[model samples]
Target: MILERIIPTVLSVRRILRADPALVKAYGGDPEKHTSLGLVTCDQDDAMYVALDEATKHAQVDVIFARSFYAGAAHASGRLSGEILGVIGATEPEAIENGLDALLRCLEHDACFYDADGKRTVTVFPHVIASLGEYLSKEAGLAPGTPMAYLVAPPIEATIGLDAALKAAEVRAVRVQPPPTETNFACAWLTGDLDACEAAAVAYAAAVVDVAAQPRR
Candidate 1:
């Protein structure tokens, strides 16, 4: 198993309502209106990413930065760092709080990596977004309401699994994360009809299991 379900969620909020000019501009944030900040860390990196996108639809927020530490959360640089750090910005403290709440809710019910087979060691994350939210629409460069299959896994598994996913459904790969990602994983964002996206996710899960069962003889 890549990781058991003992991962804890980390969210640290700072009262930067109206934002700090020097810090905002330094981070390439606009020097305009009000803004609050939220610092988030998660054991599962890509899972938090989809939550970030979902949060944007629930609240007026922007992803300031989201990064996975080199390697994974188990070998993190410090405590509470998790496998990733995602920062978000909003016009008000209340909006920031709402966005964070939305993120937590989505993470709990919507997104997380999983073992490919029942009680197997293979790991994969295949999520089908029924409709694109503001942030995900931008990331996929598609309009809202588009269905997308968000796929992620370790390098070899992801690469091969995506190939299977593409062949299984009539989908388009809108965004592909090549090997050696920030956390040494790979990912792909596929867009298509809802049914097609779901099919692709299923195919991806199957492919991950196949890869893990490779013969080493």
Candidate 2:
């Protein structure tokens, strides 16, 4: 049997709505928004709870997905990108991919979260071609390749990595972890095979959770 694990990264609705007043009016609410909005004022943990609640409703469905709550205050008010990405990248690559794939699948349907103004604010997943092209140019110092090449390269690399990992392992496993905030973690999972990739992903998820559960120094 094929094992798969998923972890999702999500944004807070209250924070988003607060940032843009236009969102409030879009959801059929009064144009004259109050300084104190009740429903959307919760913190990242609250946002995660909302996202998880929504995810649970769709759990019985065949589609795959997961959700992780992120502190909008940290991202917006403070520059926590480095720290956030570090936490996320600490997880295994395979785990990240599975979670992302499931998230993408969920996104395909209308299950994505919307702001009070009804604007879709979810952007946890990255586009393959654009992401890969940017990576090659920026990191690898390679010129942009053909669209076909860009599309094929990531999966091919994934397949090779999966094959290698599977050969090293005695048994198959499913892995999952919270999505990373940095481009590095996201790109690593994208650069491998879809089938053999799950084990590494499961391993990564397990590691990430273990680390997160550990007491801070």
Best model number under TM-score: 1
- Per-residue lDDT of candidate 2, residues 56-82 (tens digit): 232321111112225333344333221
Residue-level lDDT tens digits of model 1 in 1-217: 5333322365443446666777776665665643577767878888888898888888888877777888887688887777887777877888888888988888778788887644635578888988888877887899987889999888888988999999999999999989888778899999889999999999997888777777241
Q: Which stretches of candidate 2 lie over 4 Å from their true place?
A: 1-73, 77-105, 108-187, 215-217
Each model's TM-score, in the order given? 0.89, 0.24
Tell me the whole-model lDDT of each prediction, alpha carbons only: 0.80, 0.27
Best by lDDT: 1
lDDT value for candidate 1? Answer: 0.80
Candidate 1 residue pairs in backbone clash? none
